[model samples]
Target: MLGIKHNQHTNLYARKCNMKKHLSALVLAVAMILSAISGVLAEDITTCTDSNGIVYQLSEDSSYLILKNAINTTGPLTVPSEIEYEGKLYTVKEIASKAFCGSTATTITLPSTLTYVGDMAFAYCPQLTKVSFGRSKVALGNRVFAGSPNLAGITNYSGVEKIGYGVFDGTEWLRTKSISTVDSAVYLGKVLVAYFGNASSFNISTSCTSIAPNAFNGNTTLTSIDLSNVKSVGSSAFEDCINLSSVTFGNSLVEIGSYAFDGCSSLGGEITLSDTCEKLGAFAFSKTSVETADLSKTKIESIGNGTFKNCDYLNSVILPESTKHIGNYSFQGDSFLSDINAQNVLTIGYDAFRDCSILSDKEYFENVESVLSGAFDGTIIYEDVNGSALVIGKTLYKTEETEINLAVADGVKSISPYAFYAAETAQLLALPTSLESIDEKAFISLSDGTIFVFTKNEQVYSDLESLTSGTIYVPEGNTIENENVSVGYITGITITKNPVKTEYTYNENFDPTGIEIEVNTVLNGKESSYNISQIGYEPSYTYNFSASPIVTVSYCGYETTVITSIKFTSVPGDVNRDKNVTSDDILLLRKYIAGLVSEKEVDLIASDIDGTIGVNSDDLLLLRKVVAGLVSLK
Candidate 1:
């Protein structure tokens, strides 16, 4: 039981459309002005049924008729201005409210004598596309054509005077029309939906507060769009318009939807946003030819992801102090981006500056506090030491291609992560005696490179030992204790304890009759127990424990043991086990306190001996005291 309704107000858009004849042109005019103002009911009511079984409530005196409902079916309806009711001719003055509110009629033609269209009379007519309004049809009701998204072209609305609100509320016809002239501007209520006239550059009407999404999208002819009075621009509103060069924004625009100006490659002039713009949507100006995006005067708090991506010609960007974050890939592929002034930025997302190859080291780290990985991939870095190293700020990155016999420059105390990473050309690396610290992966991938140590300092060499490959060549007179390089025992090594022979022999037949094996700390997944009776021995055999790995041993069941060693990674109060405290221990302590030290680098419990809470200066001071012989681990 579907029905139709005509609301009490009319759509005042009147135009002569030159569409096909089968598609009837509708004329929606202002509501019943003459009769309502004059306070006159044209005729008395009478009921009648047409030959097609359609019911009509007619007025007897004025011959006015209202199609109330159809008995069998609704038609591509034709409402005549006059109809014979019980042989009495009645003039159809108006369609009553709810008369055809939800009718499925595909076409409707009104008579010239019709007037006073009632509230919601033709509302919710889904298939009611072709509609022809009579010259006398005047008044319209609210939502008269509401809920009809496909209601097609309407005809001349020249006779219209007062239009009601929401007449075409749910229709797509309102959004697809060209902007009409000032005398015939088409509007959805007060909102101007489209423009019909020819103008190279256009100004949105001051009467319109907002421009609908895709209103001017792909409109190639529109060169410049001035939105001085508009409050918001919808998503993709001006997208793909290659010729659109300039856009003038009003003070009222606060929110820009995503992809608003994407692919406007020829768009020129600086994208100087107003101070009122707080939210900038993703890809808002992506791939545009704008030379600069000076956001210093605006309130935009963050630059969205891929916002300026692939804009190869963008030379400079000025971010405001109000901006706190830069989204991922925001400035990626902006090859010409040489200047960026984000002095107040705190966090930069991954790949934000990737492929922005021209940005100098000074501009890259100006105000950046934390950088996600790959942020500077494929970017430029100045050589901190000419012909020696490619540098990011004061941190040494990698050496130049030609320098294989590396002499890490003096004053370079710390080797930054990935300093010599993947430099297969580097066959020999010579460390300076002044070198203080080297971060992880600083010497990674230099597997075949020979490390030359100028400093006899064991701690300095220890930091470099596990990080490099091949043999390390120490300077003449520099002693590398064999215990610093080997750890644990290969099978068949001899055990000599005090008060016994310097070399021990094993017999397979005796089950621990003379010698006993006691296990202590063992490397992960390595052997912890051994059957002494089955153990084979060699004369004067020895196991050099690298970093001094120690194990207790007994000969002939005596408790007196002769072997002694220390493991640097597991040793307490000896951060680097250089046999003495120096700047290395203090540096490790500081690194541990800074959350930059890994457990494999130092024993946590050994590092935090004071045991207050997290590692701090007090623990460092206590460790220094132990190093100074004021305290002991026991």
Candidate 2:
């Protein structure tokens, strides 16, 4: 019985040892499972070394592999599109940010499946000369290839929609690629990205609608441009094109963006704008060599700041009737501009005409309403009133210093050329009605002082037409018919004679229109009335008459004049003539805002009653306020 008990105990001990061994095996399996699951859940990044000794990370959730970094290599390296790790394959989709930043690689090829490239991924890679994308649909982050000025070309198979700003900001070589695969030109959508041909002169394709910003920037070899189909020229499009001498603009072109041709110093000769051009952005022609710019045909309403600043060789500027405001520094540093015609300009910004050294004292202020300080500098200025007036070649060059008011002698028929050039003293000047002509750029820099004219003869209107600032007084029977005849600027001119009423009737009510009348007036008290139309002196009168106008004659000795008047005979706020202040007026206001019509199309005085002095969106809002009972039209 003792032997049987010992054998049973031994069997029990064997069973216990077998249970411990099973427990150990079970624990080992659980630990292995937990470790494998944790590796997938917590440590998802799988590191692998490529054949080229480049380290790449493959994440389980990632659809593609990422190139983390590369080992030092002497030659070009191409990244594989697919990476296999632990029995899984991941397509290389993106190059991680800063993956190859400042790399010394001479050339690199992106994978075919790459869709995204992080910022600065390969930036500052000085030796990187060629970058060829295998696929077309790749997106680049900001500055992805910035600071790599040595890049010869970036060949792509497809177009990228979202290109970050400054992606090629400092890539100077991209501007002068003399050889391209497609007509030596690169395009991004409908815009011309760059011209890589060696041709000095280029004609844009008809299919191109616009030129991309910096498209041809820093292209010094380009001598001329022919843009017959482009609608808009982007900002900095031709900046620093030092050799560009000629430009043939397209008929469909409308807007010239800021700095479009900022530094084209060789573009000399006559420059004229077509009638379709409506806007000229700031610094559009800054630092150019344009000799003469005639904008008479353009419909541009505003001259942007620095539009012609530093145009050292610019000699003449002809502003059109559509111009309203002259922005600050528009003509600053134009040393040679001697003549300027800004007939419809209302507001002159500060430094608009500053630093025009040789620009004569010929002022064209026929319609100038406001003149800011420093508009004219670097020109001759007449300071003291005490000394005798100095006349050079019939031009009053300078005057002696004096504190009292000044006056020209009665027989002084003309103000000398450039007289009172850049004068900025607060002193009055008296003029005789006998003064006939004043040279250009005269009275340009005058102070806010009064100018008294002691003559009833209305022929003197031509002499005072260019007086921008300073009040002027004329006879009671004469009137200065100009937009600058404001309350503070001009006074004492009146029309004592009653105007003859005339009318023109139409089948349907129409917008107010201007009428031209050929007046037969006798000059020098002679019965024979000369036709001045042959001499370009065609007087036109505008009237809202209900019937055909009847000719009215008047005799003024040297010249006879025909005059008539027709009034709208409507309330102040009735812009649309519906007899009510409604939304129609707002529509008209919007039309004016969109540059569809001018202030003369509507009631100018009433529209200006919004207290803004000009017809703009503010006046529209004020009229809307009146309609909403938020404010009064009065």
Candidate 3:
């Protein structure tokens, strides 16, 4: 019994030794993990002040450092290229926004590793006089040196790729440099910063490669500019230059920023874009009088919003084949604009061509994949025949009524984009055989219940199948199979040939003998024209002796007018129509010949007594002789 008890005690001691060893191993593992976590936390420190009292912060991914703030540092601060923190080195890549604002630094020297300077980095520095940029190109944020009253010099800025607005505003650098020479322009390296002079025909410096924003804004006296050496024009550079009529763009020109030439009302004639020009920003040429814009040589891919809006005299625009998108109101209110080449345009924005009264190019939207609302509104290509429907150059632009079945007029070659957008619940839509293309979004907003009845089988029917869930039916013999589908409506009429006998006596009936009227009707899904019998149809008009009367020819609820003359039967030498050649008529004729009486007051036909096609002194003499019965009234 004593030996067994000793064995049990030995086993318990052995189990206790194993548990102690496992606990020690766990403690060591946890300590190592904690040390690793603490190391990562140190590196993750978002912000820290360096030994020189300059604040620094980690970049978004903690891969680099950004110089955050040094406002407390006084004169001649030089930013280091790299900052060491927590035993690790990080490259200082950027300066945070407002980093040195309100500082008393006399000068700032940026390191070569810096890529960007945030907005207002050194702004409001009262004593700042100079900023030395790095060797590499740096993108500057807005108002970088604004309100720095003593700042007068900028060094190594030739590598700057972008400069935000008002960067040098309220600074000694801009003020002194702007008027330093007879040119009255400020040049920051190769960039033309600003022009404050009132020269009417100023030429840009030959050495300039770029122009800064608002460079020559609101210059009323600048009538012409020679930009033969410029490469880029910044936003609002020439805005509101009311008299800037001539501009010579060079081949090196690449970019024209937003509102660059906006409101230059006198900028007329052909504007030939440079072949290297790629970007044209929003409202670039809005409200101008440019007669023709030839962009075929440019590399522009899209036209921005309001780019050419309200250009009253813009007659033609030749877009490059590279163009894909047209933004909202791009060409709105161009009244005389008639021609455009946009065959490859993929998307058109809202009101892009709205109120372009005479724009009638049929193939402009052939390959367009998308079209926003009112793209072609108020154009002359479409006629407002009915309140809800329009016929645009052999295309049905839109139909809004759902109560009655819609019949597309015959000879309509296409259906415009979003033609049935407003008629979502429409029952039936009839299509003509003349359709060759259906534009994108033609059946948008249509419901499944809507039926499309085509007069003949067409490839467009297959295209429509992919666009909508509506039922399509092609009838036989150029007629709609469904009787409910209304067809054969009169779309329009034309006065092909006017009456041969236009002249008639006052109060005479309108003679329809020589009149030829061609009536246009949609019959059995086909456009048909026939000459209405001249004797069978009577025209409606009121006789006017002085002016030509408009004769209205109405047939099948469609009407068109023909202009014809109906004048009073003139009696020779009877200037006053009293049915006699008397002394009163001779006196009137004499007064007309003397120029005392106006042409309208006297009957010119009656005053021409010799039938010489005019009322002159010779006619008056003949009338006087007739009144005296000298040669007897012929």
Candidate 4:
């Protein structure tokens, strides 16, 4: 029995040793698994310390830590414009390319010092709906928020002149949005045109005088304009605005620059021009397809070159009676510009009315005298006249043409050097025979068929007239010919040399008349003491200036205080040389002419008479005597 118990105890001891070994194996396996799990968790979010001993972020040492990375973290990242990590202020210059492509941002407010933004920096951020840029000009990088399915905000800063190419490439989910004024301010900073894709419409404020060039260009949604306060419209300010349909202006608007509404073919409104407006710049309303222009009260002074170049729909226009100037190519190539009623215009710039063919019945202005170079070069006026274009030789002219009663105003003596060459607009023209000269290129730039007409030098001074289609009567014995066409496309070309002709006859006649005067002095007293009581006389009236002077007149008891100042009645007189006189005297001319010659002058008519007696027949006699070389009158 003792031997059996010993054997059982040994078995129990063996079993305990086996249990201990199994427990050790289980603990070792569990420890290995726990270590692996811990390693995976730690690897999930990598970390890296910055140069300032502050941790930025990290996956791999070479990975970038931009504003929007691939990391999925609940974040409200604040990127300071000027980073002050340690002590130095470094610009957080770039949000690397495609950096924050799809970040979940509630609101993104940028700092002021930011300079560059990487392309598509904030693209496709579903939760990022609002963003505000500080003072710095924000360049809308390409595809910044392209696929943001729920994006709803639109920037309207005035400083961003150019919305970068494809800035909203895939922003298809935008809803319930209008451009913000801050965005407009940004656009202004960039001198960019205000487009209507983001903003439904636009009407410029009165305070804003000029719309920047290309300001509203390429905006298909631009519908209408109220230019009440706009005084000037810039070049190409609204080019290619397919949706622009109407336009109206206040009296304050004066000038419309080149390409003002070019390519705006949808326009269909009447532009009312106030008399207060003076100039219309190049292409002011060209390509607008305007139906009418109200110029009843217009007193336009100048029309810029190409002011209505391609506005083919307008057929009739009524210019003001005071219209004076037209710029180069003012109505060139306008297919429908049929009528013009320029009244007192003097100068028409180059190619003023080229290609205007349908204009047939045009007779409104009177006092028609001058036509500028290429004034009607390629218009129907140039193409239809039976003969050659009119010849108005070189020289700047002040007064322009009217429908009747021609008269050239001052500052203008002749036509432009190349006024009308090779132009065949008129077959016959009757010029003022009093016209002394015709300068070079006076008959240039015309069709080849027409001829210049003139009458006898003296007869032309008669009533001014023109034969619509008839014979041309040039000066006698003069060699004139149609200008050579070698000069490319020259119209109204007629070259005339200043030829010597028979001298004009003039007659002169003169008649002489004489007057004499003699004054008899029968003074009884050696010293005459007589008080002169004479009313004032005008400068035009004759005075006894060189009459003799007595020492003293008969002092018959101090006669009634002898008031020197008195109102006297008289006829009219000439004082100001305006050829008439009344109380409108300048008050000084009478004194200057009344024997008041200064001794410094040698040629003055000096008439010295004593004021001792009244101005009677004796004084008149003395004045006539002076005129008869008996005395001098100053």
Best by TM-score: 3
Candidate 1 ranges beyond 4 A from true positions = 1-148, 151-172, 175-198, 382-634
Model 3 global lDDT (CA atoms, 0 to 1): 0.74
RMSD of 2: 23.7
Q: Is candidate 1 or candidate 4 better by TM-score?
A: 1
Candidate 3: how many backbone clashes? 0
**Maximum-lDDT candidate:** 3
What tens digits encode model 3's per-residue C-alpha lDDT throughout 545-608?
A: 4323666675433568877765658777767767788989878878877889876566666777
Model 4 stretches with alpha carbons more than 4 Å out: 1-197, 203-209, 365-368, 372-374, 377-380, 388-439, 442-634
TM-score of 1: 0.39
What TM-score does model 4 achieve against the real structure? Answer: 0.38
lDDT of 2 by residue, 206-264 (tens): 67767766778889889998877776777788889999999988677788888999999
Better of 2 and 3 by TM-score: 3
**Model 2 steric clash total:** 29
In candidate 3, stretches whose alpha carbon ends up further than 4 angstroms from where it belongs are 1-75, 83-106, 384-397, 402-425, 428-634
| lDDT (10s digit) by residue, model 4, range 1-634 | 0001112343453345345435545765776688688764222322222211222232144233333343242244445443222223244434555666766764566655445556777777777665556666554554566666655554434333233333444453222222444434223334333444445566454345445555676778768877776665656777788788877777876666677787889886577787677777677777777766666686576777777776778776667766677678777777787766765666667776666766544343233345555556555554443332233322322122211112122222344444333344432233422343444444333332222222233323121122123223343343233233111110111111211221111111111111111111112222112111111100111112112111111111111111011122221222233433323322323334454533222111121222333333333345445435655544
| TM-score of every candidate relative to the true structure | 0.39, 0.39, 0.56, 0.38
